[model samples]
Target: MESLQKSLLVTGGAGFIGANFVHYWLNTYPNDKVTVLDALTYAGNKENLASLEGSSNFKFVHGNICDQDLVEQLLQSGEINTIVHFAAESHVDRSITGPDEFIETNIIGTYSLLKAAKKVWLDIPKEQGRQALEHRFHHVSTDEVYGTLELRDPAFTEDTAYAPNSPYSASKAASDHLVRAYHHTYGLEVTTSNCSNNYGPYHFPEKLIPLIVTNILHDKPLPIYGDGKQVRDWLYVEDHARGIDLVLNKGRVGENYNIGGHNEWHNIDIVKLICQLMDQAFENDKTLIEKYPLAILARQAKSEELITYVTDRAGHDRRYAIDAEKSFTELGYRPQESFETGIRKTIEWYLDNDSWWRSLIK
Candidate 1:
């Protein structure tokens, strides 16, 4: 596929996966312009995009996606041809505790973006609509919208029925439906990708991987909810970003794609792997190990002892896996990082960038 000149608006570009995509998009297409609209919520950190602060190709706008006036203004500036919507309240635990934000951000925010896109891209004349034909709205979503899979059930496919279990997943499912409805009803050029669990640099410590890494560093108990047997298909964040790029450029409009690593691991297994890696790192460099408090160092030396089980999360899914064959067959997409390589890299990133995450912790 020929590369099109893309001036993109990346919503929620300050959050974990969104921030990574902003960096990825700028590096991959240096000639393209990117404007990031982020609300700077707790999960959205301006520092995530600090490196791109002065880049000519990048601009960061502080705003909410639900603000229809702001979204329409940005789109009508005629500078943006693509809207990559990523802003959402994505944590399941937080959704259980407080679901209002999930509905407002995930459902209402997505509706606002879609409505604005329709007005800006579809409500114009034939001659002037050439740019609209080239314009695309790419929605990034999660696989949990398909709900859990039994131990022997097949991985989720693009055609899988929506059975969202938590408020977070349900909100995403609603947003997905809205995107599809807009595409079919309004003739809007849109594509959606439901990706598996993503882990990499800039991941907040609240999630499993970074949480375990941080907990181990501090010699705190590694809290495992329930039996830690819940399964998730793990995709490296960069690979997911690459998949998004492929789908945005090459995928058929009005279609949905599934992006995953084809790597499924039990929650406990991932924690244990981090512990083992930490142990090895500490053993290899005693001086590095000494940087931690003495008690932390002692605990880090025997990382497994820190494992502790807690009550399970509400509506915890037993397993989630994705069948990304459609992406591979249609878009020539394939993950570059294996779990072993990706996990090691993620751990090293957290270790090397202490201040980056420490600030978040504070």
Candidate 2:
């Protein structure tokens, strides 16, 4: 990828995928600049971006994306020409527990950003508009937009219709439509990527992989919904970040790309794998490595000891797979990390970064 010189606005840069993408781009291009606009919600973690604190090229604006005045001020300013928005309430469980926040942030916030950009990009004064950029609004989205698939169903591609099952996904679908509308009616240069499940460092503890890891570390029972047969295409955080970079820099305008690792696993099986990996991480300890590492688990363990089945989430998607061939072919994208490599690294990150997530539980 050729390095481009530009300043970009990132909403929700404090969250997992957004933060990872922010770090990825800044490190890849030294001359480029990034100004982050985050609302600092419960899921947003400012501590994750603490390393970029005083950099000349990085600026953190502590505010909500839904605030039209703030969003308009920044867009109409002279610095930014590109935007990668990832600031949505992403947790399905939390969306179930309380959905009002999701509607407020995901739908309303996205609408405000679009309207602000349309106004400034098209109607601003020449003095301000001369600073206008070949702007692109890259919306980072999820595979849940296509809803679920049957066991033998083909993977979801860019053309898949929206059939979101959860409130979180439903709200994302609405936002996705808004992005598309901005492109068609207002001619906003935009792209959308609906990706599979992502797991990696800096992830909030409320998520599945981190939740399991934290609970396992605390010797708590790892909870699984239903029989745990729900399947998902697991993509690494870094790989997902790279995909976003490709879409923003190289993908065609008004296009939607589906991103995934092509690695699929049953939920129950993944849990067992984590348990076995935890045992391996605990290997040097004198307590239990001898018995578990007797075999490096190719699949997860059946340790009835740690598995606990809970009530299934209402409207849970049975399976989600992504046919990411377009991104792979057109954008020259391939997952840099395999599931095995990614999962091990994810486990290591949790082990190393205890202090960050420990605060969340408090």
Candidate 3:
């Protein structure tokens, strides 16, 4: 396959997974022009992309995906034939507390982008008697849209029925449906990937892995909900980026791919693993003890002592696993990191980058 020099408009490029994707794209294809549009929400931190500010091929735009006019302007101005849509309200807890933002951002915001892309990439080109621009609107989504699974239940495939339980997942499901509609009804070139849980550098500390690593450093309680038996398939953020790259380069339009790490673990087991890793880190480095005096438990090689059981929240999904055979066979997508390697990398990131995650803590 011929490699195409891409001009990409990456929405939500300042957030955790999004920021990592931007970094991966720029590093892998230095010549490609990449533009990021982000709202700088609580979860969206511009600091995540601070290093990329000096890159000649990178541009960051402060804007909301809900602004159709702004999205249209950007698509036209950059001649962005590829849009990597990553903007969405993704937290399940936040969705339960307030679902309005999820619906507005995940559903309506997606609609806004689709409208803008249709106009600039398709409608206007036809109106001006120009050749149709080769374009792809690749929507990044989560496997949570498939809802929970039983212990013995089959993992979620691209063909899994939608059974979202939380407002966040429901909104994402709606947006996924809209993306499919655009492709089938209007002939818009589009692809969607439902990815497993992503963890790595730049991940907001609110999520499980980072939260435990951070809490361990602060000597704070490691809260486990409902015995922490809930299972999830973990995907490294960079691996997810690689999967999307394959999709853009060679995937079939109107198809949905599942990107997974192929590594599943219980929530409690994950927390325990981090505690063990933290203990090892502190043991290996005496400076960690002096640098983070509050990490007394980790220093003592007893971080698990801080573990505290808590009542689980309502509508908590039991297990989520993704079957990525389709993505693997069709797009040559496979996660490069296993849970052991990925989690260790994640812990080291938090240990070395205190300045980054510390600023986010209120």
Best by TM-score: 3
Query: What's the CA error at residue 40 for candidate 2, in Å?
Result: 1.0
Write candidate 2's Cα lDDT for 1-362 as tens digits: 13557778999998898899889989987778898999888988898899999999888999999899998888767457888999999999899999999999999999998988887776564446474446878898899989999999999988888899999999999999999999999788889999999999898988888887777766567799998999999999999999988898899999999989999999998988888887666754444334223322311333336678999989889999999999999999999999999999998888778778888963
What are the runs in model 1 whose C-alpha is more than 4 Å off? 126-133, 294-300
Look at candidate 2 and give me any clashing residue pairs: 272-300, 272-301, 273-300
lDDT of 1 by residue, 1-362 (tens): 13679999999999999999999998999999999999999999999999998888888999999999898899877468899999999989999999999999999999999988888777753557454556899999999999999999999999999999999999999999999999999888999999999999999889999988888888788899999999999999999999999998899999999999899999999988889888888878776665665336434468888899999977899999999999999999999999999999999898889888987773
Cα lDDT tens digits for candidate 3, 1-362: 12668999999999998999999999988999999999999999999999988888999999999999999999999989899999999999999999999999999999999999999988998999997688999999999999999999999998899999999999999999999999999889999999999999999989998999989989999999998999999989999999999999989989999999878999999899899999999999999988899999999999999999999998999999999999889887878888789889988889999999998875
When summed lDDT is taken over every stretch of 10 residues in candidate 1, the lowest stretch is 292-301
What TM-score does candidate 3 reach? 0.99
Any runs in candidate 3 off by more than 4 Å, and if so which?
Answer: none
Q: TM-score, each model?
A: 0.96, 0.92, 0.99
Instruction: Record all residue pairs in model 1 with backbone atoms less than 3 Å apart, i.e. clashing.
Output: none
lDDT of each: 0.91, 0.86, 0.93
Model 2 CA deviation exceeding 4 Å by range = 1-4, 125-132, 285-304
For each of the candidates, the C-alpha root-mean-square deviation to the true structure, in angstroms, is: 1.7, 3.8, 0.9
What is the Å distance of residue 294 in model 1 from its true position? Answer: 5.5
